[model samples]
Target: MTDYGNIDVEQFFTGDPIEDWLDLKRREDISTGTVDSLVQKLQTNSDGTAFQQFLSNRDVGVLDATVMDLYDYRDFIREVNSKREMKNKLSEVSTFYNDMRRLKQTDSNPAAFVLSRTDTRVKLPNREYHTVEAMGDFLAFIPHPQMQTMCLCYLKYGLRRGAVVNIDLCCVNIDDPRYRPILMNAISNFIGRYAAVRIPYIFTETSAQMMWLMVRNVATETSATTMSYFRSTTR
Candidate 1:
């Protein structure tokens, strides 16, 4: 009907969710951002079918799976699938694949059948030091102020990524007897080792006092020298 300029709709999508989900690869993590995005966009089974058709037409032998399964072993699955040689042999691959038609039939681990294809699960942590650019790209999804604080604590203090949320002033002190020495001890041991500090979130009255006292002591120390002889040393 009407003439329209050549436009690619693929350029329109921002891929924010996909990027967030993919970033987990650096941390040995997995997320259902892709499936969740699909589920949210695909309200009915027919929508899933449409996607299935698209995959099939593309000769992608992908199989349907739940969220949990995907998270548990996304890395291994990704590695195996990413083989460039396989592209020439196979159009697509499945983690729990079977080759019953072959003379030497084989089946994948049975546990794989029950695994979820959607969810967040991490079996390992990234061992190699993350480059600044890589970490920035991974953390860029989180922009909220408080969330940024939480992320910083993870990168700076080495706290577990998710555990940062439950903590408040009560449960954390740079010098609490239960926590301070341990963290300091860890830091002293790992001046450059970069160990993480994990503090259980257990708020209490003592923690409040301890933190306050530490702050007061710090203020007193810093000002003590500055305030001394302020009126007249020369006079």
Candidate 2:
């Protein structure tokens, strides 16, 4: 956060704190997809977003909001939505407050304190793992060669769909006696420094052959053509 003593309240305050904070987000270099999603959430939700509804109900300025106000919003989300949904809503509100605090718009972050109170454990559904026989069936089911190769990458290396599409041909060196055949380069954790994330392709010869064939095809394909096909097919 910026120096508390240096923060000029008169300069920062614009009579409407929520409008000013939202305008800050608009001018920020945040992802367009993220902004769109946040906007859609506020627009689509009948009760409005956690903070939006809170401000509407209380008719209080953003700077004047208290920790109790945040708890009230959290309770409101829990009543109308699942715990997981409440968690997400709280996170968004916390992020907004933290951003404002960092910019010297506010001294305290009420949502940050409320986050601990709203934490809940969400249960996940059981998943079935694919056996060798099941794998063969899955491979056979996918008729498209490139798509099958992509699936093989997922099955053998546990590569995410996004990572599979972004795998660079230059990083794949089959001749190198490395444990992993393919490397997902410069995968940023966002929380830490960038690092290379390797996905092992140490499966059967059939899978390796399919992967190598796809690699060869990718190597020969033009960038524009590959991107066009990737965009069209993925969508």
Candidate 3:
């Protein structure tokens, strides 16, 4: 027999198992927002029976619920809930069963069996793509040099916002007269250290020059050895 020494098994097995699971989640330091969402998804009765009451009516405890019972519940919710809401409900119940299994309270997770099909019910819309001319017009109107350089990087490299923000000065090699003034000033302190680094040029010469010009105009002090390529001047 498994030894559940000092474990309060009664907390999970007696009264409402859903409430017990939520209480345990609170003790585990789950964020209040997450716990409130779980409560809304699992216990709210705006449309029909609460999940706990539904299980109770069927004479099925959380540990004893079969995959078929969960499927029946899915059908019940489908009548009133949108496809996305139905999917979220199933996902939260699956998480509840998973936690019960971890505590050795049940041998099977019935909710897990049905979660795989939840995505097939919801159809996602196709993404729209912008034409090059449209993107160019948009870039032309962005008043700031920094914003223009960021848009150029996105256009050329398909870089995400975080990826663009995380770019370091040492990553690119710029060789343009427009950039020389700012580049000389920005890297004056790190000349010897980065001289032989030989990092390849990721940005086009024009974009690199624009980025350097933005950096020179915004930064009051250029003494740092290394810094992010794009940063807020207000800081």
Candidate 4:
């Protein structure tokens, strides 16, 4: 939603005020952020025409109608009640209209604007991390060269750590001289497992598994040294 946007607000409460309901929901043990976001999403719909129409039809000269007045029979009330299905769509339509308005090229509705609160959460862009000493110790453990070569081979071929530890069969190909003899075998599913399906790889010995191990050792050591400095500083 645009920060510069505002429109006159009209409130409609068919059975109960929505904000009151949100207040009650917030009083429970549920997530505070969820409650806040829900209220914010609803408040975004200030320019809803159908909402305005619903309010317009029901507006009294004064807010003096008794509880019994709502149930009292009127022909137009029955017609309006028949259109109850349309009320919920107003939020969605208003959002769509606002999207068009932001383009500022073709949207004709000068009055249309979304009034939602801006998201407070912001994600910073990704950047390379500085290396330190602990990272070297961890990498040192990988190139142990004794364990059956599968441990080092797995990482050497760029396979995941978990996959390296778990694979017993053809994952570590011992006979191939041209390749690193380690292969990426399996990953799981989207809704199901931690990762989905297998991605296959065949790396030549020329791919330099030994060099990768050396680099990993250097990086891990550098990271660990950095962490030790921070620990001392904090203490």
Supply every candidate's count of residue pairs whose N, Cα or C atoms clash at under 3 angstroms: 12, 0, 0, 19
Regions more than 4 Å wrong, model 4 = 1-93, 105-148, 152-235
The clash number for model 1 is: 12
In order of lDDT, best first, we have 3, 2, 4, 1
- Model 1, residue 171: distance off in Å is 29
Using all chains and alpha carbons, the TM-scores for the candidates as numbered come to: 0.16, 0.19, 0.20, 0.17
Residue 134 of candidate 4: its Cα lDDT? 34
Per-residue lDDT, model 3, residue 55, is 86
What are the per-residue Cα lDDT tens digits for candidate 4 across 1-235?
3576864344433344776678778889879889988887677554454434344456732256555544543444677676765766787677766766676624454333332333435343221232435333434543235532553453444323222232112323221332232322211121123223332222333223333443333334344455556657954
Candidate 2 local Cα displacement, residue 231, angstroms? 26
Q: Report the lDDT of model 4 for residue 173.
A: 23
**What CA RMSD would you report for each candidate?**
25.5, 22.1, 20.8, 22.5
lDDT of each: 0.42, 0.54, 0.55, 0.44
Rank by TM-score (best first)? 3, 2, 4, 1
Q: Which ten residues in a row have the lowest lDDT in candidate 4?
A: 183-192
User: Candidate 2 has what TM-score?
Assistant: 0.19
lDDT of 2 at 63: 77
User: Tens-digit lDDT track for model 1 on 1-235?
Assistant: 2378676655644476455444444345446675555555445444356445445555554565445444534654466567856775564344324432242335544344334443445333212343456445444533346744554444543423222322112223223345545544543453233223442232233333333333323333333344344424622
What lDDT tens digits, residue by residue, belong to model 2 across residues 155-175?
554323223333233333222
